[model samples]
Target: MDSGQEALTLLLLAPLFFICMVIEYRILKKRGYSDYSLKEVVCNFSLAGLHQAADLIATLLLMPFFLWLYQFRLLDFSLTPVTLIVLFILQDFFYYWFHRASHHIHWLWASHIAHHSSEKMNFTTAFRQSLTYPLSGMWLFWTPLMVIGFPPSAVVLIVALNLGFQFFVHTRIVKKLGWLENIFNTPSHHRVHHARNPEYIDKNFAGVLIIWDKWFGTFVEEKPSLVIDYGIPKQVNSWNPFVTTFHQWRTMLTLALSTKPTPFHIRLRYLFGSPKFADNAEKRGTTIK
Candidate 1:
């Protein structure tokens, strides 16, 4: 499916999405654990709208760039049943690195924090994407697929599929999936990914599969003993979607262009290095929580 087809698919799934949200709310409320306020749900939808708008602007650059790269395709691979399967794996692999980098690298995190800004996790939270992602160089992560001869159409369609699979894993309503949790990116694994706890930080970066997290040292299984605290360490406690979207951008600029006779290298580090590096440049490792 192309972008248009993907849009149609998501549109068709809207009712199901609403139903899932309602069911999750009802169940969680029954269990006396659901804390989702009406205003919070509205915030989720608003942020999602903001993300979709920015995503459209992003495709203006991404679609053309991928197509241009496809012209120099090194090898022509037909989209057989086998090739699509291989491309899906490749796409997931690349998405892993992109997702991981977005956490470790400050510049990338500026665009990614929006998705994690919400303290609550639900299907709607998956829609809370950053407006800055396109400019944050996320599109460049997939360039390797184009250079390696994967058709642009297949590359984009596979990416959409990966994203579609990820939406359901955002909920706290579902816990472990028994055997499936061992292979796929289930809600349990993703809960760890979204966690603000020291042990859970930056773990489980897989887009569709959990195997990549296992291959990478980044994988951390959810600990039933410890309660998961969702949201980033630096919280954005605003209901305004624009405020949530631009919070990091403002923070980045302020940190990068500080009035303190900050050296060029330090400023550069704030713009490109680890999120914590900007403060106390020599500081290393996780600051004790």
Candidate 2:
């Protein structure tokens, strides 16, 4: 039942992740970038374990659904290079929308917030993943490929590959790759994505292709005028991985349930509104208007 890529990627990339982490650390240390801290790295590894474990469990649970959907596909897709290439492009397209939705929708943001909780940016920071990402509507975004006849196994493998490529882009050590920065998701684009600055928030949602952000009008160049401030607008302020994972959910639930005296529309807004709308309301001394 294993997509070969799962075992293969773990076998290969596990060591590669370690080596890359060491390389990035050395490179940053040589350049005198001291943002990488021990506690944050521990949390990153712990979160990565939880995140991948959830992905494995979700794959087993959802395999049947993907298989069932495959039967209904209008056109059968092979795992040939041409097909995989197309799906990779297609998957990146779907990823942009899913990533965008996670930013704007509170329910999804609860799961995604953990990834942006880290104050430091580095290759290891990419491992700061949400443990509940499967339930955050990530797999739902890839469903169209299954319905379009990509084999369940191929769909799963391609997703893993997309993520594998994404891990390398989470660093500050890399500069713009000249023309490559325009077409693909590079460290420059991804740094802007991870940045909390006003211009960077909710921009550059593409997983592999920077073109999606460009085409969708969500692209922003890493500004020379403004420094990239990494992490979420409202910092989590703790190294507890559990707190990092579920703090957003707690805030969302408290707001949603505290609307006993407020209107029904406000409760709905609390549930479905922007990531920090409830907190922002309290900050501004205004109820949902």
Q: In terms of TM-score, which candidate is strongest? A: 2
What's model 2's lDDT at 154? Answer: 79
Q: Write the residue-wise lDDT of candidate 1 on 1-289 in tens digits.
A: 1545445556677888888888888888899976677777788788776666666667755677678888898888998999999999999999999999998788998889889998988887888777787789887888888888898778777777788788899998887899997789999999999999999988999999999999888888888899999998878888888888888877777778767677787778788888777544423322211
Q: Top model by lDDT, which number?
A: 2
Q: Which residue runs of candidate 1 sit more than 4 Å off their true CA positions?
A: 1-6, 279-289
Estimate the overall C-alpha local distance difference test score of candidate 2: 0.84
Cα lDDT for residue 134, model 2? 80
TM-score of each: 0.92, 0.94
Model 2 Cα lDDT, one tens digit per residue, 1-289: 3634553675577888889889999998998889789899898888888888888888778878778887899897657889999988888888889899999898889999899888888988888988788877688998998888788777777788888899999998888899998899999899999998887888999899999889889999987678888898789998888899889888887777774577778877777888677778656655675
CA RMSD of each candidate after superposition: 3.4, 1.9
C-alpha lDDT values of all predictions: 0.81, 0.84
